[model samples]
Target: MAFNSAPKQFGTILLGVAGLGAFVLNLPAAAGRVTLFIGQILQALAPPWYGRNFARQLVEIGFYSLPVVGMTAIFTGMVLALQSYTGFARFSAESAIPNVVVVSITRELGPVLAGLIVAGRVGSAMAAEIGTMRVTEQIDALWALSTNPFRYLVLPRVLAAILVLPLLVLVADIIGVTGGYFIATARLGFHPGTYIQNTWSFLEAQDVISGLVKAAVFGFIIALMGCYHGYKSRGGAAGVGTAATYAVVSASILILISNYLVTELFFAQ
Candidate 1:
């Protein structure tokens, strides 16, 4: 029995070794893909820019995403105010509600939530559009016509996202703070003037700037993941659908991870 078990144990060990080897090999492959994707972006920045396409994408990503971002921000701010009051009232610190709402929105929630909403809305759309082009051999047709697909399709969207997301986040910050203000004054029986003063006095320029910076970085990550997955898509329709899902998931995860890193950079003690 011991001799027979020895062969089975050796087989399991061999399988584990092979799995580890494959995992190690995938690291470099992923790195190379990232390198190539970035290279394409850099090259797209050269002459023969697609101004019209860039404008279109800007409207699509920034303007079109506003309603969703706005609603999310408004409700988030309201809830924050209500919750802050509930917790602070226990300690007789209800006066801190305004400060908490403004600081929280500007420092963290505004940019993060806006990025997530856009990642879900625009990122998936980008992946589906480009992946479909890839699957249908339209990308190959562009190559045949001497038109670089990255320059035509990828650059506009990426640049638009990088440029527009900060503005979106700024708007979200304002709307969120306003929502908090309304809920505090109207629903929670707080004095409007005092709440506004507390929020204004407690808020700093650094908070807003940090959030905008985070928005820009998040935007870049969102577009990068979408384009990278879509550009490399294979199989067929099923593959395009999978690429869309991957784009949203990857962008959302990167947004959260990078959010912590950026916060540490700005606020770490």
Candidate 2:
């Protein structure tokens, strides 16, 4: 037993060292991926713009995404109102519900929720579509035809996400605030006029703008993660499925991380 314990301990130490080496090896690969993604964005801005593809992506990512975004926003706002009232009651600050709802929605919840929703829906769709093309050799076909896949496929989706997400966030802000107003007036016995006044007075242009900015960044992250995973996919159908899952998960994590960074940039004292 004593002799076996020493061997087992050495094996465990070797495994831990190997794991650390693997992590260190991955760092440069991750940097390469980020570099490639940036290059693609730059290429997207150059000539040979595909208006038709861009329009289609715009409709798909923005218009089709509205219903889900709206539902999430409205429900979030309503819940915030209820919770805010419940919490503030202890301090006799129930009158602050409208201010809290509007501020919270416009400043934080609206963009974050919308980004997460779109990332799950649109990011997965992008990954699936691109991964299918990769596994089917359609991407190679484009290269054979002297067409750049980055410009033709990646640009449209990325640009559409960056442009349309801000608009979606704007709509989310309005719907979320309105939902709070309704909850306040109809159920919470808040004076409609006073609630509106308080919301308007408390919310600044900075809050709305910061959230929209976050939305645009989140959109970029979503599209980038989706396209990157899908474009790099291998192993056929299973790889395609994995790409879709990675797109959603990576986009979501990036959204949360970027939300905090952007907030710090915009509001840090």
Candidate 3:
């Protein structure tokens, strides 16, 4: 009996190995699909666009998202100020708190945190909504009506996210600085005027611009991942949930990766 079963076990092992190889090979095809999808989105950028949809998307992505972003910024700044005080105090460099706060906020924390928050919030929403539309055949209905789904659905959200994220990052930068200032003056007994002066002096335009650039790239990645996953989703409600998860996870990972690349490009030694 054992000798007879040997062949069957070997066949099963071979089948498993083949399946794993197929899965590994499919990664390149999946990447190609994503690249093509991105190309289509960019192609839709030109020509007469849906102004109303774009406006709505802008408000949805930016204005509605402001409160959460602001709250996050303020708290982060406050905490950073306190933390900087602890470290700087050890070296008798407490006077550098304002400089540290401003540079850190404008250069890294503000954009990175805002991108992550939006990825979790807005990116997931985009995936869920689009996936639902896809599963329900709403996208097909649009195609039947001679309407371009990419133009009507994807473009507006993508453009809105790309445009507004920079603005959001800028606001986060301001709010973060303000929060740091408040914490320093009210809790740390810092002189407000001196703190403000130090922040102003140390902050360079390049730092702020770099953060905004990072925001734009992050926005593109977020929207693209969400739309790509949603548009390609199958199955049913389970697919929608999967798409949302993929969107958020992919967007966040890409954001961090892009952040480092952009930082290197901007400030490489």
Candidate 4:
């Protein structure tokens, strides 16, 4: 019995290994397909640019998303300030908290949190809506009517995300730093004027620019994953659900990866 069980376990392990190898092999192809998809969308970028769809996408991804992003940023800033104070107080570096909070919020946390929030919220919605349309034959109907799905369906979403996310991140940076200021001054007994002065003085244009740039990249990734997965969804209802999940997960992972790369590009010595 043990021998038989051992063989079964080994077979299972071997199957898992094969699956992993297959994913590794297909990664390049998957990447190529995404590139091709973006290229086709660009090629389809002609007049009639679907102005209404772009407007709707802008409101959907940006306006509806603000409250959640704002809340998350404020709370994260509070936590970061409190946590930093713990370490900083020990080193007699409590005065640096304002500079640290401002820099960290504008340069890293603001863009990253905003991206993740949008990915989870707007990205999933795009995937599910498009996936449902795909399953319900709406996309086919559009194609039959001589409409290019990339232009009609995808282009607006991508463009709106690119335009709106930077704005969201900018708002988040301001709110996050404000939250930290409130915490440091009220809870930690910091001088309010000095804190504000340090925060304003220490923050640079490069830091804010880098974060906004990251937000744009993250927005593109989120929209791309959502639309791509939704477009490829085939198995009806269950496939739509899978596509939504894939959109959120992939957007989030790509956001983090791109965040690091952009940070390196901007700040690496």
TM-score winner: 4
User: Per-residue lDDT for 80-196 in model 4, tens only?
Assistant: 899999999998999999988988999999999999999999999999999999999999999999888899989999999999999999999999998999999999999999999
Backbone clash count, each prediction separately: 0, 0, 0, 0
Off by over 4 Å in 2: 1-17
* Model 1: CA > 4 A from native: 1-25
The alpha-carbon lDDT assigned to residue 252 of candidate 1 equals 98
lDDT accuracy of residue 16 in candidate 2: 100
Tens digit per residue, CA lDDT, model 3, 208-246:
999999999999988899899999888899999999999
Model 3 spans with C-alpha error above 4 angstroms: 1-24
How good is model 3 by TM-score?
Answer: 0.91
Candidate 1 local lDDT, 1-269, one digit each (tens): 99999999999999999999998999899879888889978987888988999999999999999999999999999999999999999999999999999999999999999999999999999999999999999999999998898999999989999999999999999999999999999989999889888999999999999999999999998899888889889999999999999999989999999999999999999
Q: Give the 10-residue window scoring lowest on summed lDDT in candidate 2.
A: 36-45
Cα-based TM-score, every candidate: 0.92, 0.94, 0.91, 0.97
